[model samples]
Target chain A: EAGVTQFPSHSVIEKGQTVTLRCDPISGHDNLYWYRRVMGKEIKFLLHFVKESKQDESGMPNNRFLAERTGGTYSTLKVQPAELEDSGVYFCASSQAGVGNSPLHFGNGTRLTVT
Target chain B: AQSVTQLDSQVPVFEEAPVELRCNYSSSVSVYLFWYVQYPNQGLQLLLKYLSGSTLVESINGFEAEFNKSQTSFHLRKPSVHISDTAEYFCVLGADKLIFGTGTRLQVFP
Candidate 1:
C-alpha cells in the first residue's frame, strides 16, 4: 500500500499571500491528522479528521488557518494571509484506526516558506 | 495536558557503537508511547510503540525502547548502530492526540 502523500513538497509565498497544502492518505484509512513544525521546533498537532467530519481541531493556531477533508479521501490545509511565522513544515498523517495505539503513516511534508 | 521531552538534541556516535536516546513524558492521563524516525527527505516512520502489556518494545531493525512508568520515560536504544541509523528521532505521547518531543538528531560517523 502506498504511504500518505503530500503535494508541493516546497512552497514559497509572500507574507500576505495564501497557500494551500494537500494530503492524500493511504487507502481505506479513516483517521487523518495535520501537524506542523516551525523553526526546528517540535511537531505540534493541528487537527484531526475521521472520514469527512472533523474529529478534533483544538490545536489550530489561529482563525487564518483552515483544514478540510472532502469525500473522506484527501485533506487540504489553507492558510489565508499567511504570515512569516507560518514558514515551516506541514505534515499530514493517517492511520487505519482512530484508537490510541494505532500507528500513523506520515507524508514527506510540505515545506512552506513565507517571506 | 500532555508533553514529551527529548533530553538530547543531538547525539554523535561512531558506527557499530551502542547508543541511547533519552525521552521523558508528562501526562495527567494514561498515554501510549511511541518512537518515530525521520530519515533525510523521508516522512516520519514508526520505529516502535508501547500501548500496554509489555514495557519493552522492539522494532524490526534492532531498535528497542523500554517504557518506565515510575520514571515516565521511554528511552530508545540500539546495541550497535549502523550508519544508516542516522536520522531524527521523536518521542511521542499519544492520548486523544499525539504530542511530540523536540526531537533528537542521531549522527553516526563511519
Candidate 2:
C-alpha cells in the first residue's frame, strides 16, 4: 500500500509570510494526524482529523495556524504571518485501524524554514 | 499534564555493541508507550510499542523496549546494531495525542 505523501518537501519563507503544507494520506484511512518538530525539540502533536470531522485539536499552537481536510481525503496546514519559531518539520500520518493495533504511517515531512 | 523525557541527547556505539535509549513518562494513570526512529531525510517509523498485557515489546528490526510501570519508564535497547541503525529515536506516550521526548540521536560506527 502507498504510504502517506506530503507536498513541497522543503519550504523557505521570510518572517510574516505565509506558507501552506499539504498531506495526502493513505487510501481508505480514517485517522489523520499532524505533528511538528522544532529545532532541538521533540515532535509535538498539532491536531487530528477523523474523516472530515476533527477528532481533537487540543494541541493546536495558535490561531495563526489553521488546518483543513476539505474532503476527508487530503489535509492542508497553513501558517499565516509565520514566525521564526515556526520553523520546523511538519509531519502527517495516517492509521488504518484503531490507535492500538494500527501503527501510524508517517510521510516525509515538509521542512519549513522561516527566516 | 502528560510529558515525556529522554535523558540522552546522543549516543555513539560500535557495530555489534549493545545500546540503550532511556525514556520516562509522567502520567496520572496508565499509559501506552511507543518508540519511533527517524532516519536521515526520512519520516518517523514505529520501532515498537507497549500497550497492555506485555510490559515489553519487540520490533522486527531487532529493537526492543520494556515498559516499567513503577519507574514510569520505557527504554529502547538492541543487543547488536548495524550501521543502518544510525538515526534519531523518539519515545512517545499514548494515542490521541502523544507526548514525545526530546529524542536521542544514535550513531552506529562500523
Candidate 3:
C-alpha cells in the first residue's frame, strides 16, 4: 500500500498570494491530519478529517487557512493571502483508525516559501 | 494543554555505539506516546508507540522506547546504531491532537 502522498513538494509564493496544498491519503484510510513545522520548531497539528467531515480543527492558525476533504478521499489546505510566517513545511498524514489507536503514515510534505 | 520536550537537540555518536534520546511530556489527561523518525529527504515514519498495556515498546529497526508514567517520560534507546540511523527523531504526545517535540537529530559517525 502506498503511503500518504502530497502534491507540489515545494511551493514559492508572494505574500498576499493564495496557495493550496493537496494530500492523498492511503487507500481505505478514513482519518487524515494536517500539520505544519516552521524552521527550528516542532511540528504542530493543524486539523483532522474523518471521511468528508472534519473531526477537529482547533489547531488551525487563523481565518485565512481553510481545509477541505471531498468525497472522503483526498484533502486540500488553502491559505488565502499567505503571509511570510506561513513559510514552512506542511505535512499530511493518515491513519487506519482514529487518533491514538493507529500509527500515522506521513507524506514527504509541501514546503511553502512566502516572500 | 499537552506538550513534549526533547532534551537533546542533537546527538553525535560513532557507529556501533549505544545511544539514548530523552523525551518528556506534560499532560493533564491520559495520552499516547509516539516516536517518529525522518530520514534525509524522506517523510516521517513511525518508530514505535505506547498507547497502553506494556510500558516498553520496540520497533523492527532495533529501536526501543519505554514509557514511564510516573516520570511522564518516553526515552528511545538503540544498543547499536548504524550509519543509516542518522535522522531526525520526534517525540509526540497524542491527546486531542498530536503534540511534538522540537526533535533530536542523531548523527552517526564512522
Winner by DockQ: 3
In model 1, which runs have C-alpha deviations exceeding 4 angstroms? Answer: none
Error of 1 at A9 (Å): 0.4
Find the 10 residues in a row with the least total lDDT in model 3 chain A. Answer: A95-104
**Clashing residue pairs found in predicted model 3:** none
lDDT of 1 by residue, B2-109 (tens): 899999999999999999999999998888999999999999999999999989999999999999999999999999999999999999999888899999999999
Model 2 interface RMSD over true interface Cα atoms: 1.4
Please rank every candidate by DockQ, starting with the best: 3, 1, 2
What is residue A87's positional error in candidate 3, in angstroms?
Answer: 0.4
RMSD of each: 0.8, 1.2, 0.9
> Of models 2 and 3, which has the larger TM-score?
3
At residue A26, what lDDT does model 2 achieve?
97
- Candidate 1 lDDT over A80-115, as tens digits, reads 999999999999999989747577999999999999
> Which segments of model 3 are wrong by more than 4 Å?
none
iRMSD for every model: 1.0, 1.4, 0.8
User: All models, DockQ values?
Assistant: 0.84, 0.74, 0.88
lDDT of 1 at B6: 97
**Model 1's chain B TM-score?**
0.99
